[model samples]
Target: MAKIRLADALVKILEKEGTKFVFGHPGEQILPFYQALQNSSIKHILTRHEQGAAHAADGYARSSFQPGVCVASAGPGALNLVMGVATAYKDSIPLLVITGDVSSQLKGENVFQDVDINAVFEPITLQSHLVKEPQEGIQLLKMTILTLKTGKTGPIHLNIPRDVLQMEVDQSLLDETVELNLPNDWSNLKPAEKLVENSKKPLILAGAGVLWAHAVDDLHVLAEKHRIPVATTYPARGVLSEDHPLSLGLLGQRGTKAANFAGKNSDLVLAMGCRLSERTLKGLGDVPIIQVNLDEKVLKGSVNIQADVKKFLEKIRKTPPKNTDKWLEQLSKHPKTHKIRTNFKKTPLKPQRAIKEILEGKDDSILVNDAGSHTTWVNLLIKALESPSLIFSGGLGPMGYGVPASVGVSLARPDKKVVVVVGDGGFQMTLQELATITELDLPIVICLINNRSLGIIRQWQELYYGAPFQVELDNPDFVKLANAYHMQAKRVDSPDDILSAVKDALKLNKPVLIEVIVDENEDIPLPE
Candidate 1:
């Protein structure tokens, strides 16, 4: 049997599994893998930082609905990926994190660029492995990929020592594949069906699981057939169109007034694929919660169903309970207080007005938002229209996710217009990726909301800590920075000019940055 380097074999396996891109920064420890990548069909995207690579991969996974692959060298390089990994883990985004390790002989001997990468990632990963031999490494890689694709999906880590990657392996030894067996029990769904049937007011709380299961159509069908109003969590925003009469928009903190009102009033809450976080379930007290999820561990409600969300929805769609018209009519009478005042003509434009304008008619465009106070504005105000998905870091809301994730989204869906909404504080974290965007010439529009501070934390300080201290930021001229990267750029300080600026940005064939200046003291309005 012909022998091949383990690194070469690993790339072949990735190709076999339909991996088209690998996002990361290469280093001396991972040079062999980079060399192996040179001859493969897979494209390598070199990010500005290791954190950028991890975030880009995460964004790719979320948009593409595939296991995103990222590689980094040992020590600092691996540590840099921790935040991204944690973000993906919390959100259940599928990722395959590959890190280079010190040679086996030098283990614990303080070799260069060597740290306990597996130990650092063990808590965050679905599974973490250290490759000790070539054959075992290939098998472990195959298993890791399978784990990434199956059951409540999440990231997995594979730490391969430099010498093992360079070792020779028989070609036939790398041909094994791992299969995933997922559960499909419909036994407990009857009680849930009855719960919905008997309740005077029932609501559907959809979460990211609906999107992850590719069950958007089923979800819509189930909601419409039963006339149950749907209130989605942030990650599941676009599962149903916000324009749909049965849609209650986003629910929870920074959620729409109508959605929260409906949730609080509903007698039976059919929480599907949602963890029912405090932010999502706020103001609702002791509602009869029926939770359904693929992972049994996260399911908590009066009745729990552990099954594929799509299959369960399909089953219920076939035999939906009657008498939901009155419920729908009652919800329709609830006033919507989450409206964005687009008519506010003020200098230092309001973030709400800016988000409203950017999302006005771009229903087909994808909105990738970074975590901050600005995110709250976008969540409450931005209406996701036909086929437009909103990507957000729900559980682990990281600051630097917006820009690089937008790059990944653009790469994954080049046909769709990708828009990034990020605050000045978050944007500065990964602003180095502007070069990557220009280099690829991806047509992404970046809506940089410049409030000159860590807006979310500042709000917390003012409300609870008495004063906003240590949250102020010294930001660069974003327009100038965008121009430096050879991209078109503009700054908008007037509310009335926001829509025009966004329209102009959408017209450009390449990436454009629209820096909208807003008051630092402005607070996001809470739902009444």
Candidate 2:
């Protein structure tokens, strides 16, 4: 019988976990693992950069509800994946990051392309390991996937040595592949059901966890049954159709006034899978908080129900109160308004107006927003469409996730309209990805909010720094950049031009960039 290699065993474990694709870049250290993957059923996507691979994996995981997988070689390759891994960690996205490292014999000896990948990922990964032998690779890979799927479902790192990847392994080692079982704790169901049943003002704040648990429909039914008003975190953009009666759009600082007030007045706050970040907590002035999270650490606050959101909701549905009409009516009448028109500058073209125009009618569109102060408008105004949308990279807050993420998102769900909103500073981080968009023939609308500065840093300078130094930027003409990449391009200077630009771009059904220049000093204030 042909002996199996440790690298082959690791791939077998990943296959058992239902991982079908991996996003990565090839490098010298990981050559052995790549060679091993050659005969495996898993499909690998070669990315332009390590960060792109990580974000692609994140996008894949978010779209498919499976753990996104990424691989990187040693030294610079491993270093590049850190931000993406950190992003996955922050967003609670289950990710399996396989990295190649220097051989154990030469570890800590400063050899060529030798950096401690395990130590590099320790700060970001929920769990990390350095496999010293081929046999250890099988155990570490299996356990890491289980750890990521359990608790909070974040990123895990496994660093494999070159020697270990090439080491011979016995076929019996494949028996070590064990899928960890998630504990079923139905103990809190009765108490949680009673809390939901008895509360006059009940509210449900859903997050990415709901999506991860595949509990969106279940949660929706529970909310409707209990007449609970529902609000989603920014990352959980399309947990439910925004047009639903119970869906109160986004909640928190940029959230609708009614949603914010509802959260404040809610007697029973069923915060499922939400981290209660400052952005979601309008000002938390001692409201009764009931948290249902897989992460045990999150349960220490207010009332903890340490269970998956799906199981908790299943139990609640069986015993939900008969009458929720009064609560539903109150939530329904929370009022809608289009009165607040931002006056950032005298320019007829406003960034907010352009965003509103381009994204106005179609609700099925997916928006990939990049971090920076310029994107504050989307946080405040971007609403859910008819189709399920993906909002990526909230946790790591990396600038470059926008373009490449859209590439992966479009690739995963080809029929949906994928729109990427990025700031000038953020756009530069992965501007080269426009080639990927053009090459893929993806209908991705690139809306560049060009404010000629690091808008977030500038906002900090004005609010806290008091002196802005390197924050200012001399930007490239995005229209020209788009042209260079063989994509349609447009420059919008007037607010009235936004809707038309977006409509045209969408109609083209091809990649296009809409560059909207906004005043640099505009500050989007947070709700106190």
Candidate 3:
């Protein structure tokens, strides 16, 4: 049997797992692994910052419904990826995160750039372990993939030492890692099915789990066929097309009034792939809930079923619709929840008007969102179409996610143009990725809502505290910044020009930034 370096063998194993790309920033300790990648077909994306690489990997995972892979060197390199990893974990996005470590002998000693990586990541990841040997790494890789797909999906971390990566492995040992299989799919659905059959005014609360299970179509069919209204969690925005009459839009904190109303009045709630967390269940009183999720620990519904959302929906789809004329009539009274104000004529561009204009004449572009007051507007005003794809940091609200995530989205879904909605505060955080977008020449439209304040913080400060301080921003000329990056840049100071400018930018089909000037008054009206 021929021998191979452990790093080379791991790359081969990643290939077997259908990993096509790995986003990362390399350091000296991981150079051996990087060298081994030279002979493989796996594409490596070099990001300016470790956080960018992690978020890019997250974007790819969220967009593709496949495990996104990212690499970082040990200690500081691994530490920088914490924000992105925690964000993905909060949202339950599947990712395989690799970090290079010091040689095993020096792990506990205060070696340069060395820390307890596994301990640091254990809180954020489903599993965090250091690879002890080449054979152990092969098995760990397989286990990581299986764990990601099987139960509560989230990120996993593997810290490999430099020497361990360079250790020689007997080529025949590779055969031991050849076959992979998931255990018999387990879900207790009989009680769930019975509840579905009996409920008259049932509402389906779809979560990010629906997307992870790749059951968007099945969910749509279940809601439409049964005529049950569908209210998605923030991350599950596009699970059912927002245009559908039965769609209630997002529920909870940043929720639509209609969705919250339905949650309050529904006789029964069918929560699929999403835990009925406090953020999602606000204003929701006691109601019988049938929850289907991959993670058993989070199943707190009245009828908890550990099942794949797609499979569960498939089985429940056969249940016929109940007579719900009264429910529909009551819900119709709250139909004002999802209307995009198409005609806001505010000076200094209302964020709502800006979103409408940016989205005008758009055909299902993948929307990437950054966290801020602008995020509320993007979520509130924009309507997801048939097969809508959206990526945002739901669990952990991170500011710099949009730009780098868009890079990953562009690479993963080359056919669809990317529309990134960001606030000045958030954009400034990961602004360096503009270079990455330009270097790849990705067709991305950056809608930078340049309100010179941390708008959301100001809103809270004024509303609840009767004072606003430290939230205002001192911004740079974003147009000049974009130009400096050798990308097309436009500044829209007038609200009316947003429509035409964004339309033109969308047509360009290349990387461009539209900085729309706005004030704090233009932020989202209090969330319903």
For 1-528, candidate 2 gives per-residue lDDT tens digits of: 468878777787777787787888999888888887898888777778888888888877777677889999999999999888898888888889988888879988999988877887897887888888777777777777776665469888888888888888787877765677666566766677777667787778888888888888898788876677787887887687777777877787677766777787777788888888877876234577778888776564477787888888887776655476776677667752234475444584566665666567334678787888656767666667432474767756888888877876776677787888888998899787787678768898988888888977877777777888898898877898899999999887877677677877888889989898776776766554
> Residue 42 in candidate 1 has what lDDT?
99
Name the runs in model 3 displaced over 4 angstroms.
Answer: 177-188, 339-342
| Model 3 Cα shift for residue 259 (angstroms) | 2.1
Q: What is the overall TM-score of model 1 with all chains considered together?
A: 0.95
Candidate 1, residues 319-430, lDDT tens digits: the string is: 5555878877777877543656666676767777777887773456788999888887777777766433788788999998999988788888878888899989898889
What value of lDDT does candidate 2 attain over all alpha carbons?
0.78
Pairs that collide in candidate 3 are none
Model 3 lDDT tens row, 1-528? 799998998898888778889999999778888998888889998899999999999999888888899999988999999999999988888999999999999989997987999999999998898998988887788778777766568999999999999998897766674343432244456767777777888889998888888788898788777678889888888678787888888888878888889998898998988987889989466898988886877889998877678878888888764777778778878863566675767575667777777776455788899999888777777777644477889889999999999988988898899989999999999999998899889999898998899989888888889989898889998999999998999998777787787778878999999898876665467755
Where is the poorest 10-residue window by lDDT in model 3? 177-186
Per-model lDDT: 0.84, 0.78, 0.84
